[model samples]
Target: MDLSELLDDLIRFWPVDVDDVSLIGHSMGGLVLRSAGHHGYEAAHEWTGKAKTYVSLGTPHSGAPLENLAHQASAILAARPETNAFGRLLRRRSGGIRDLRAGSLVDSDWQGRDPDGLAAAMAAEVPLLPGVDHYWVSATLTRDPKHPLSRVIGDGLVLHHSAGGRNSTRHIGFTEDNGLHLGRANHFNLLNDARIAAKLVDWVG
Candidate 1:
């Protein structure tokens, strides 16, 4: 099933009350949370009203270039008989992976298209839920924030700009105070960083 459908099922069967609930999404989980709250989705309004805070950790909010590259690589490999099997395996990505191509938060973002093709032309900008305090955390491999490696291999997966919700065409516009950058950290570390955990506690509290 698609991420949206899975999210819908999750929300539908939620046992606890959603009022005042705060969501913390790491990596692709962040995208799922955003998708659940996108206006294009029916559940968006319901969750948005109850959600107090939205925190994303090392999420590819502007799409993951790595995945895009992988798609291209897979296609090329699949064309060759020698690596055809391996390439075919790579090409057979889950619906969730396809959705990540453009950080799609709505069904329409990837409803009917070539899963292997470039990201679909976005129909509209998906805005952040109003009244919900949105937070972003990004990590960098370099110790210095200004290091060239920091920009190129941000967290070794997602770029700092993308994770921090900085987009050129569309604005997620999370306040400076709501965003944090950690140096000498990789993508996986964001999940267990004591500093990040503390911030989440503080924010949720």
Candidate 2:
């Protein structure tokens, strides 16, 4: 909501008549941007329509398995009275963390559900803007995406397929040419990689 409001303010007060803009998001930031694009304030359509390109860097578009595991762990810990405090802290994650379970992009995706329980099924899909170009970048700590380690510990958090928006169940409609896989790169490094910066410039140019 804050981000949506900020974007609305920026568009309303910007000096120039910004017809187009490029959005580059990293990690959870990407999901927030997607949510804003899907359902923001009244003026959201006006500003979001100006997005010529949307780039996601190491975003868990299909949800993070690691967070699921943490959710389970927290549940177990909460069951024991001795460590209940720590478990409570973990269970009380921000909405952003809870939304990561299924990479939620709208309020309807999670509203009225128990945040600590299993991820709620999305009631409706959030489609991208018709004219906007969506791009994704994924990082892998291993040299080969096929490696067992890479599959389990992708970028130490997100799976390669999830970050690249290649899940078989969901179709975000990103083109093959728009997805890039960076070898030996961790999730955080995706934000600072020169290659990623170059690709963003090229794509958004």
Candidate 3:
């Protein structure tokens, strides 16, 4: 769904004002913050007493391999400027995105284009505001039991390196019992899992 439309719906259904809100988002939701000029932060500032903490689950701080498919699709779409959803999705978010370059993950092209949410976020992500703590949860997905990721590090969909802040991060296993469970949790589980809801409340409190 469109970001604006989603937010509009949130405004209607969510009873909390900005100051009372604790904005939590996942992959595209984080990108939405950047695209919409960090509406999460703004909402937190307006409703909550502090800038909302952001934790990105499976959000590619560097960039995602999915972009490669998007770039290929854009080519198929006649190389229109930000006309494609995937391409436009990364651009509209933040600025100074370096992860979307050719061979980076998605686009895999050296060619350049206008600012994107991915780029914008990379540039402005540093020196996070007070009370605005951001965490990254990475996943490594693979069917191979002997896969290096399965053997070493990952949540399944995201690599260990992909989790955390752009310049800093904390890698947490979704499961507290094992760091190398070699299993993948759905993206939302990293944030809203049954085990972690209390933690989230504590963090937001």
lDDT of 2 at 110: 63
Of 1 and 2, which scores higher on lDDT? 2
Runs in model 2 with CA error above 4 Å? 41-44, 119-124
- Could you tell which candidate, 2 or 3, scores higher by lDDT? 2
Which 10-residue window of candidate 3 scores lowest in summed lDDT?
A: 172-181
How well does candidate 1 score on lDDT at residue 77? 85
Counting only residues 3 or more apart in sequence or on different chains, how many pairs clash (N, Cα, C under 3 Å) in candidate 3?
Answer: 31
lDDT string, candidate 3, 130-189, tens digits: 455554445455544346854343453444444443323332222232122223564545
Worst 10 residues of 1 by lDDT: 39-48
What candidate 3 gets wrong by more than 4 Å, as runs, is 1-20, 34-49, 72-127, 141-147, 150-157, 166-183
Q: What is the C-alpha RMSD of each candidate to the true structure, in Å?
A: 3.4, 2.1, 8.9
What value of lDDT does candidate 1 attain over all alpha carbons?
0.76
Residue 190 lDDT in model 2? 86
lDDT (tens digit, per residue) of candidate 1 on 51-107: 689899998888776877788888888889999998989988887786666677766
On a 0 to 1 TM-score scale, where does candidate 3 land against the true structure? 0.48
Pairs in steric clash, model 1: none
TM-score of candidate 2 to 2 decimals: 0.90
- Listed in order, each prediction's TM-score against the native is 0.82, 0.90, 0.48
Question: Once superposed on the true structure, which residue ranges of model 1 sit more than 4 Å away at CA?
Answer: 1-19, 39-46, 118-124
Task: Tell me how far candidate 2 lies from the true structure as C-alpha RMSD in angstroms.
Answer: 2.1
